[model samples]
Target chain A: MFKRIWGWIQRFSSPKHFYDISGKMIPWFAVSALLLGVYGLYMGLFVAPTDYQQGESYRIIFIHVPAAWMSLFIYMVMAIASAIGLIWQIKLADMVAAASAPIGAWFTFLALVTGSLWGKPMWGAYWVWDARLTSELILLFLYFGYMALQSSIEDQRTADKASGLLAIVGVVNIPIIHYSVEWWNTLHQGATVAKFDKPSMHIDMLIPLLVMAFAAKLFYAAVVLVRARNEVLMRERNRQWVRELVEKI
Target chain B: MLKAFYHLLARDLRLAFRLRHELANPLIFFVLVVSLFPLAVTPNAELLQEMAPGVIWVSALLSVLLSLDRLFKQDYEDGSLDQLMLSPNPLVILVLAKVAAHWLLTGLPLVLIAPLLGLFMYVPAEANGVLMLSLLLGTPVLSLVGAIGVSLTVAVNRGGVLLSLIILPLYIPILIFGANAVDVASDGLSVRGQILFLGAVLAMSISLAPLATAVALRITASR
Candidate 1:
């Protein structure tokens, strides 16, 4: 049974097979992400109760929390794929890792911007030296570094291996960096009142946040598939199957 | 294996000695950076003292980064890297030796001079010892981690900027702990925890970074 599953995965690893499979799957992901996104936004923005403490500005949590989750989630995915690519020499996995970088970066940027907007009213500033915010900023830098390294190398294979190594290294350091920053932040600021609105999450807010997070993940899947398909086409352009597929398209 | 490691370390040190200017550039950069802060920021001793830990640590980190390109590029250029790869000894041992040599040439100098830089920055006299201790524990980790980046990009001409981009994020934890140790000490607080964290990071990097560096070197060199 294991061998059979492994054989299936091996077949799916082929660019042509992956291209066909992803084409069929991408629309499902896109449509689900769209439906979920609309419902989530409506519920999160309109239905959730206003925070008595933070008032309407707290609504930014709907965007900020989900984006931050995606930022971390996407990096985890990228790093795992990178490790697989490195260990197994799987081109498809490398392509997936490469495709994940920009999407992850966008999520990280969204988290930062939305968090800053939330902070202005709550923390009385556009930015704070809070541990969470600082760590998110570092994560953004990591994504940019991965992309920069990828683009600098001319050869696609070399770029994949090098950036994959970097992604793995960055992932390993993320937790340590996050904790160190947290420690440093607390040490420097001895008496700042911690006002991060961590009230008991009601179901109304929880549902939408969870829905939006799922939608963001589905969106990642749809976009990564699209990008991975493009990578496959480029890498396999000279092959007969790809030529046929391109001609058909 | 031990003999081969010694030979590789000795050879790298000899070459570094012969190319004295390359060895001096990063030290010079470190001094220039630390000196510039007084002029660029403020000459106020109190303010400088407060900013001293962060300024010195950042300068040392950047100088280490500035010197990373020389880690593997010369050997790569002169075709000795291929020969090193072909050697019967395990690549990880050889790479570790190279990284050790790199730390001696670059990191060790920074550590030794950090106390002097701290004085120049007007750091509290009590903090100078902590500053030197932090750098001593921290710079080896920089060399070890920086070796991975240097190995990855050794084949690519003019990868210095790319190298910085990739490695700088990985250096943040060390920077945080190292700077904070001195800062805490300057504030007359117990810095034992920060010192312990730096040592842990150093130990972890020493054990793991060489293996990663060896793999990266093999990957970059194979092509």
Candidate 2:
């Protein structure tokens, strides 16, 4: 079974194969993402009871939490895929890393904007140089740097290696950014849900947050597939499979 | 093996010195940048002293970045990089020698001149010793880490700006610690902790960055 799964993974490492597979999955992902997102938002906004402390304004957690999670999660995916590409010389891993950058960058921006929106009503200021917030901002810069570095080089192979090295190096900053709030005395609040003992959030609020997190994952999967398909089409344009596929289209 | 190492180092130094005009630009840029803050903001002695460490550190980081591309560019262009690749000694060691040469010319000058600039910025005379020491331990790491960026981008034309974009994020932790070391020193607090942390980072980067840079250069060179 393990060998079988490894074979499948190895086979799918081909851009043509991966593109064909992910293309079929995108519509299902799109529909599920929309449905789950709507349901999550409704549950978060109306069904969830208002926080005694933060009141209705706390509903922003539905968007804010998912966006924050995707920001960190997408980077981890990018880094891991880059590592696989670097280690195993997997072309599809590189393509995946390439596809994920813009999506990850968008989610990071959303996290920052929505976090600020949530902060305004709760923290009484639009911005603070809090550890979590500052690090998240740096995360955005890292994404932009990754994308910029990739695009600046005209040679696709050189661009892959250069941006891959960068992605690997910048991985160090991710943990530091995540933990800066804990390590330093910053205005950012400490862990509410990520804590070890038990989550501090009430079950009602936590459920919608969890649903939105799933929705964000589905959204990312859907988008990554679509983007990866486009990237595959561009990169494999000279190949027989792409030529055939384009002819069919 | 040692002879080959020193020969490459000496060759690079000669080439760099031959284009002394290009080499001096980053230092001049550093000075110009350092001068700008005092002009843009008040030249109040107290305020200048307060902002001096961050300004000097940031400018030094930029200057280091400015000079970093030359660490590999000429060799890469003239096929001397190929010769180095074909050499018996491990490329990582060769890379370390090149980075050391870069630090000697670029980072070392900044460390030496920092005290003088600190004076102009109204840094107290007593903090000068700590400033020099922190920079001494810190700046080599900057060159070492910055070399990785240069190597990765060496194949791309007009990569200098992209190189900065790629490297600056990695440089932040060092900047934070390096500046904090001076800040603590200026405040007359315990500089020991911050200096130790900066040294730890330097040691870690010194060991790892060259190997990473060598791998990156090999990929670029091979392609």
Candidate 3:
């Protein structure tokens, strides 16, 4: 069973095969993302009732929370892809990891911006040195570091392997960094983050938030697939299949 | 295997001592930068005392980072790193020996000099001992983790800024706990928790970082 599964993986991960299939799969992902995002946004922005405390302003969580989720989620995907590439020498996995970096960085950036936007009216400040907020900033730095390492290396294969190792190292330290920041925050400031608590989010509020998170996932799939397709074309530019495809196009 | 470890450790130590000036540069950078905060920020002793922990830790971290470019570059350039790798002994042990030598050259001095600079920062004299102890436990982790970064980038030309980007975020945990230990000590609170946390991080990095560094060196060598 393991051998067969491995065989299937080897087949699917071939750059040419992935290019052929992912081109066809993008539309499905795009349409699903579109439908879900539209529904989720409408329900979240319009249908969900206003909070008794913050009134209409709290609705920003619909975007902020989902972006925050994707930032962390996409990092995990990048690291896992990098690990697969390192251990198995899967060229496609390396491409996927490389393609995922910029998108993941944007999500992290989005999460930070949207979070601070929400903080403005709620906390009367554009930003706070909250533990989670600080971690997100450090995570952004890690993503930049990974991307920088990838770009600085002139050799593509070496870049992939080196940055892959970095992603794994960063992932391992994320928890430790987060915990220490939390400990440091609390040590100096006594429970200043209490206002972040929401009063047991309403079911109506909860449903759209869940839907938005799922929609964000689908959006990521659609985008990452497109980016991975580009990576495949570039890395395989010298191959016969790529020339043939270019001629056909 | 033990012989290889000791020999490499001794060799690196000897080479480092031979270049007495470069050996002292990062240590001097540490002391100079730590003293700059009072001049740059404020001369108030009360405020300086409060900010001392963070300033000292950040300076130490940066100086360690500045010194890290020397860790693998010479061996790599001379092709001795490949020779070291070709040895029958496990590469991880060799990597650990190099990192230990680096700590001896660069990290141990930071621990020793921190108290003298701690005096400049008006750190509580009692907390000065805690500062040294925290740095003693913490700086080895810095060297170990920094080795992984240096090994990864040893192939890239002018990888200094990129090295900082890769390694500094990873250093945040150690900085927090190491600095916090002294801060807590100064506050007359029990610093046992912070010290223990630093030790835990040190133990983990010692076990894991050498393996990562070995892998990174292999990757660099292959390229």
Using DockQ as the measure, the top candidate is 3
Candidate whose TM-score is highest: 3
- Report the number of the highest-lDDT candidate: 3
Better of 2 and 3 by TM-score: 3
lDDT, residue B40, model 3 = 92
Q: What digit string (tens of lDDT, one per residue) describes model 3 on residues B1-223?
A: 8998999999999998898888899999998998888889999999999999989999999999999988999999999999999999999999999998999999999998888999999999999999999999999999999999999999888999999999999999999999889888999889999999999999999999999999999988888
State residue B6's C-alpha deviation in candidate 3, in Å: 0.5
lDDT of 2 at A34: 97
True contacts kept of 3: 0.86
- Candidate 1 reaches a DockQ of 0.79
Report the lDDT tens digits of candidate 3 across residue range A1-249: 999999999999999999989999999988998898899999999999989888899899999999999999999999999999999999999999999999999999999999899888877789988777899999999999999999999899999999999999999998899889988888776466545565788999999999999989999998999999999999899999999999999
Better of 1 and 3 by DockQ: 3
Worst 10 residues of 2 chain A by lDDT: A187-196
Off by over 4 Å in 2: A1-7, A177-199, B21-23
Ranking by lDDT: 3, 1, 2
